[model samples]
Target: MRNEVIFHSEALEKEGNTLVQMGFRCDACGKTSYPVYELCPFCSSGEGSKTPLSNTGTLFSYSVTRVPVGPFKPPIIAGYIDLPEGTRVFGQIRADVKAVKTGMSLKVETGTIWTEKDGTEVIGYYYTPCGKEKGGAE
Candidate 1:
């Protein structure tokens, strides 16, 4: 399943250089969760409705780490992003450790999370400084 797109496949698409992410709205509680959901984790309701997610969000929290996580090397920046969908997502931050701060504005980017041995591409969500040039690991 390494080649599988973890986020809802139908929810990802490219428009020019920007990537738009979508989420699911809880039919029961109206809570929103990113990348789709079988149930609302907040209300434990077994219902989800697909909805587009805004590319922009604010950095809720973050940390600088020299420890390796997944396909990324040392000095990785990790954080929780507070999306307009009302859900916070944990992801690899695409910025220098010294440049990250709480409440920083960001936007979603579509890029390689890693590549499989079969030469298949594994795409994943990443965030970067909003309105700025591509600002991190390439």
Candidate 2:
């Protein structure tokens, strides 16, 4: 059996929005990871404590997708972002595809991915544009 794909809860969405709204650090490292583990990617340390990450970062790369690859809607904005913590995560860009660039500053927002309990549809979380129009959570 395949592992169930988790989705963002309203609370997570709210938390993400709140974090961004308050400009909270949002980087997850081996040490700073909520679950905790060995190896710190930033400091290359096997031990480190959790710390807030800088929310400001430039877009490393992006793609304007016209096809519905999975549980996401068509014309999805997908790409990788380089965090100030020296971490890179693939996230969904919430800006208009036409208006996006390779080095644009982006504010990370919360998203959800979901799949039907018994159906074939899957969904989950992604990074989207967060601001006044996108519920800045302010």
Candidate 3:
């Protein structure tokens, strides 16, 4: 599952250097959600569509985990962000990892989610932090 993730290559190349916005558009109520969504929770509308999310958002909540989970790395800074579009998302802090905190500004980056298909890795879009240098993590 870890190997199947896909990233917005352009954004990955610009992390920490600039702030980029990601967006998602709701087809049901015509509401826009940050990050991304497949279905509109409002009105239970399947008409929801995805759009790039806001680049800047306020850190709403956070935690620093010292242990690793699955294929994920340890000493990780994780948090929930309140995007400009009023949606919240959990993300990995990609900075020095110590400078992250609730209320801090964060840029959103897109990446691929990895999956095993026929014993081969496949990638798909996944959200990640963009406040650190490009290729900050392996």
Which number leads on TM-score? 1
- lDDT by residue (1-138, candidate 3, tens digit) is 333323443222233744344455776577775444466655656676556566567889888788987555677677888877777866666656666656766765544333344544433233344445443443
Per-residue lDDT of 1-138 in model 2, one digit per residue for the tens? 745433432112234435321112224434233123345444555545434444555679888889888656778888887666555656677767766777666666532354566754333435554333332343
- Which segments of candidate 1 are over 4 A away from where they belong? 1-19, 131-138
Comparing candidate 1 with candidate 2, which one achieves the higher lDDT? 1
Better of 2 and 3 by TM-score: 3
* Residue 113 Cα positional deviation in candidate 2, in Å, after optimal superposition: 4.0
* Model 1, span 45-94: residue lDDT tens: 98767777877789999888797876678788888999876788777788
In model 2, pairs of residues that clash are 25-53, 94-129, 111-125, 112-124, 112-125, 113-123, 113-124, 113-125, 114-123, 114-124
Q: How accurate is candidate 1 locally (lDDT)?
A: 0.76
The lDDT of each candidate is: 0.76, 0.53, 0.58
Query: What are the RMSD figures for all models against the true structure?
Result: 5.0, 7.5, 7.7
Per-structure clash totals for the candidates: 0, 10, 27
Candidate 3 has what TM-score?
A: 0.57
